[model samples]
Target: MIIESYSFGRMKVDGIGFDSDLIIFPEKIVSSWWRVQGHYLQVRDLGEVLDYQPEVLVIGTGYSGCMDVADEVKKELEAAGIKYYIEKSSRAVEIFNKIDSKKKVGAFHLTC
Candidate 1:
């Protein structure tokens, strides 16, 4: 999937715009992703993505990068052997647009 544009509180992915946060899988988009703790990411927040077992996980931590992914969450991904990359939402959009993988997933927070 291609992420066309991203801004605070909104994003366009594969030509569809979304106001809420989202997760992009190889086959579909999970359009209403909300973490248990807003602005803080958790492994439980990515249950659906983990279920699909993607080779890589990309996280967009809002427009200015106000959100955070906890150490425990990083540990979980490492233990599960799932590689991850995290950056500001705009930069993430750039990476998502260029990445090439058979099964990579993206979780993007639309606002700070």
Candidate 2:
């Protein structure tokens, strides 16, 4: 899917807009994704992504980078041989859009 644009609390992907957090996979978009810990990311929060077995995973830590990715999550991704990039939502959007979505997935946090 192509991300047409991104702004505070909003994102347009393939002509559709999403106002809540979402996971973008090659096959479909999972909307309104919520983590067990609101501002922290853990391995358990990435079950779907892990199952997808993407070559790359991009994480958007919210509009202002309020969210933090836990170290354990990093270790797990590395162990699984999944390359990943963590950035604020805006930059993450750029990275996601530039990649080949066929082997990539993105988890985005729309708001702080």
Candidate 3:
């Protein structure tokens, strides 16, 4: 999926607008994604992404980078051989758009 644009609490993906947090996979988009602990990103929060076995994972940690990605999550992704990028939502949008991998997934927190 192509992420067309991203703002504070909204994102445009594949020409469609979504106001909720989302996970963008190669073949589909999962909307309204909520973490188990709200602003904290745990490994459990990424079950779907892990199951998909993407070569790369991109995380957008809200507009002001309010979200926290657990270190265990990073280590697990590393153990699974998954490359990852973590950044504030706006910059994450830029990074996501530049990547050319089909086996890539993006989980984004749209708001702070």
Candidate 4:
């Protein structure tokens, strides 16, 4: 899928706009995604992406990077051998645009 645009609290992917947290998979977009702790991220919040077995997982930690990705979550991803990245939304968008993995996923927190 192609990300057409991204701005505070919103993003456009493959011609569809999303105003909430979302998971972008190679073949589909999961909208209205919510985390267990609102602004905190955990492995349990990413069950769908994990089950997809992506080659890479890029995390967008919100517009101003307010969301916190837990250490234990990182450890779990590492254990699963999934290459992952955590960055502020803007930077993460750049990284996501550059990746060419056949099986890649992105979990994006649209706003802070």
Candidate 5:
């Protein structure tokens, strides 16, 4: 990954961005407040990084983890047969780390 920028609590990987405080795994992120800044989960983009079919996609919605993903995107993931997991950032990070060592995973996260 081309990490283009990094600061006290944030980083920009290639064009994908994230916050350091958030925990991330192969498939999910525990917190993703940074997504509001015009960065988000793009399946095709992620697919390029994974280089294979990912079993799941996880999103960490920040604080309460309340964020509504676009319906079309959700449907696309379903069509691709990728599972979706949405949760608070902390828990999402934990799950990501656990599964990352075993298989294909992608994570995006941002912190409060």
Candidate 6:
């Protein structure tokens, strides 16, 4: 589903522009306890929103980029048979768009 617009606490996301600290693709109702910047938060939030655990989770860490994917989260995903790709914001967007369009995968992207 196309996300027309959304506002979450200090974050604001719209199709045309973003006024948020982050943007979650394929926007949908989210659980309140899911924290955006918290450690291991992306996987938790995406799991809540998508309703189904994914085979892969791609994380776009902020501008400077972060290579460390939390070991615990990685273990959980791996145990659940989920692969992960962690990269900078720009590359994450490209990868997400490609997989989303081709395989109809579900993705949650957060960017600054």
User: Which candidate number would show the highest lDDT if scored against the true structure?
Assistant: 3
Model 3: lDDT of residue 7: 85
Tens digits of per-residue lDDT, candidate 2, 20-61, equal 999999879999999999899999999999988899999999
Enumerate clash totals for all models, in the order shown: 0, 0, 0, 0, 7, 0
Tell me how far the alpha carbon of residue 23 in candidate 6 is from the true structure, in angstroms, after superposition. 6.6
Q: Over 4 Å off in model 1, which ranges?
A: none
Please identify model 4 stretches exceeding 4 Å from their true place. Answer: none
> Local error of candidate 5 at 2, Å?
20
Cα lDDT listed for each candidate? 0.89, 0.94, 0.95, 0.92, 0.50, 0.46
> Which pairs of residues have clashing backbones in candidate 2?
none
TM-score of 4: 0.97
Off by over 4 Å in 2: none
What's each prediction's TM-score? 0.95, 0.97, 0.98, 0.97, 0.51, 0.55
Poorest 10 consecutive residues by lDDT, candidate 3: 1-10
- Worst 10-residue lDDT window for candidate 2 reads 96-105
lDDT of 3 by residue, 1-111 (tens): 888888889999999999999999988999999999999999999999999999999999999999999999999999999999999999999999899998999999999
**Pairwise TM-score winner, candidates 1 and 3:** 3
- Candidate 6: worst 10 consecutive residues by lDDT? 101-110
Model 4 agreement with the true structure over 1-112: per-residue lDDT tens digits = 7678889999999899999999999888999999999999988999998888888999999999999999998998999899999999999998998999889899999998
RMSD of each: 0.9, 0.8, 0.6, 0.7, 7.5, 5.6
How many clashing pairs does model 5 include?
Answer: 7
Query: Which RMSD does model 6 reach against the true structure?
Result: 5.6
Evaluate residue 21 in candidate 2 and report its C-alpha lDDT on the 0 to 100 scale: 95
